[model samples]
Target: MQESWRDEVSLLPEELKEILDITAKHNRWRKYETINLIASENTMSPLATSAYMSDMMHRYAEGKPFKRYYQGTRYVDEIEVRVMKLMGELLRADYVDPRPISGTTANASVFRVLGKCGSKAVIAPVQAGAHVSHTKFGTLGALCIEHIEMPYDPDQMNIDVDHAVKLIEEVKPSFVVLGASVYLFPHPVREIADAAHSVNAKLVYDAAHVLGLITGKRWRNPLDHGADLLTASTHKTFPGPQGGIIATRDGQLYKPISRAVFPYFVSNHHLHRLPALAVTAVEMKHFGEAYADQIVRNARALAEALAAEGFKVLGEHLGYTRSHQVVLDVRKQGGGAKAAQLLEEANIIVNKNLLPYDPPDAIKDPSGLRLGVQEMTRYGMKEDNMKDIARFMRRVLIDGEDPRKIAEEVKAYRREYTKVHYCFDVNTLEDGKLYLLY
Candidate 1:
């Protein structure tokens, strides 16, 4: 009987149908039910989402905006120009390239532009929160560059500024990267920039995790602090589509990075994301300060709550975190991998991470869990919500409550905060809403 129904639908591939079904289920579960805390992920606004689905998705306009190899992309050209301009204004930089397909691609372009084959670079050690793309096993290795690890301060949970300065002066790297995937606090950009410049080294800040915070004016701007270039993913804390941007205040470095993005790194560059990115840029320009401030507040609040619940939250001496992320040492409760899985069973999504003390091999089963509050804050969650989240986590990891039961409660709790905030309310447009212009 089931075979007969399947035969009737033979025009569509069964595998494709199953794939769509799983995707739909995942969408519902992730968007509606789970308490997602993955530091590197976020959901775009409804307006942004609408703009992401467009005719541009099917087309390719290779090369720079007006210098495309393909034809019939005049509108696409205009959008590209506008997006680049918007990004430059948002990040307060002289140049912006919205061409890299991802943050890693942006890093790759930088590695290519700044470093040739067999060049040398300095990066934060993996245990100190370096993203994989910055390491020897990633983009740097692929580009044939020798990567030297900067010294890290376990007490501060960041790069040791004094030791790093000394290392940079000694090794004299081609470039020094100053950002992280599991970032908790602000990097010593200004200090490191000074040291790198003293050695004739270019400073590239991978602001992938804290770009939104910087744009929102809650964190320091690397460009202002002497960074030569900044690479970031638009989707993380920036609240845009999944794309990468390369920005710089140094006009001389712009063209080289631009060339690297085109013939070397990306071709089409995913034109569909341009309009969505523009919308997010406009949103950040207007509401970013408030949103960024709240994200940090929520993060610190979450860290404090988790610490009170007996979780060995990191960076206590540094006031927990200044960004949207909170890191917890989950080793006592059966390590990061087990704790992450246990929390996931309760719909509390998080990622296992390596702490400063973890061995290199601990990457597969690290001793830390990274939690982010930016997405939750966007969904109207506040400091109080952070407290509730910590309680849910305690139930799973500390109290050892039944995960399925806690998951039901989490779903119910999540129902109250479905609407997105800190953006223009399209719903209000229906009623012809207006406000006084101060």
Candidate 2:
């Protein structure tokens, strides 16, 4: 096998072969070797990824379907329209535009429609898991919108409802944003929506991290709870190609946001993602519930296992977590930076995150590690598997085992899980190794 691989690469130019070698190494490392726990990341199923590669990648569609700014778009136009319908149905939304290109881009389009110079837009505070795009340092700042923060209740690990309502009523901002990159629980959508509406403001929920859970019924749909606009990435929990979507029940707001997506935020909209997005939406329609359930269950199990192994898992009073994420206050283990680096050396991937008590300046190293189970759940990991994962972390971080030795053990264990589950791919296991048959 080594000789054949060398012979195959010998025909290529040195630089090209080097690039291919790097790509192959990364794919093998991240996809098959490592235990990925990044909260904001997920893998698309085989079927969805197969559909993502197409001739549409080379084409352009500047405007909406049928009313395109370029020619040769009849087939793509139909696909785009049906994709929107598929997403709309999954979201239970009357209107959906799968054209923002990214979650932040979707937020930008909506923010542009709702705010202008000197206008205020209230957001869940950073301590409450607000994504950077919702803060003054990101899209809100780019648009010159004043970023007003709602009060966070550390005891509840969520927004302070009464104080947030009072602030909204007083400020009467143009819009309110909810959702987060480090989300673990549901936001107070209904109460905040009521307050925003009372002040003639719109409620925009960024479901970028939990779109799959929402579609699978594992989490509450923000739209059902009164969010005027729902923006999400098709990846993450949704498990599609990377892209953004905006869904809303309000036709009034939808029209302006749709227009903003085309003229202001995105130009091409990445036409190739449409078909894969549609395929994943249909897959979700069929298999999302079981997948999401396993993800949440694995998360809770992992959190418990980590705590049992002597780590400070956060949200213990709130049942650890209701979402796919399990955050740990790793400050006791030399802070999030050192803990995360140690785990990564053991072939366990996770990100250092800011705990609520940490100030914003702590962004570099933070005080917590954010772990997500959606990707591993897609690989068919169950609660027992989560325990093994936690044990691996304990060996690397607590027991002070050599990380290189742990990585070898991790690779051997990871070999048992390879094929993507909850998709149409027919897979089989031979000698404890999974193989896709079709």
User: In candidate 2, which residue pairs get closer than 3 Å at backbone N, Cα or C atoms, i.e. clash?
Assistant: none
Candidate 2, residue 432: Cα displacement in angstroms equals: 30
Clashes of each: 0, 0
Q: Lowest summed-lDDT stretch of 10 residues in model 1?
A: 429-438
**lDDT tens digits, residues 1-438, model 2?**
999997987988999989988999999999989999998788887767766777788899999889999999998999999998999898899999999889999999999999997899999877568999998999999999999999888888888899999999999999999889888889999999999999999999999999999999999999999999999988898899999999999998888889999888899988889988988999899999999999899999999999999988988999999999999998778899999999999999999988999999999989999999999999989999999999999888888899999999999889888888887662432443332122
For model 1 the local lDDT of residue 341 reads 96
Model 2 Cα RMSD, 1 decimal:
3.5
In candidate 1, what are the lDDT values of residues 287-349, reduced to their tens digit?
899999999999999999999988999989889999999999998999999999999999999
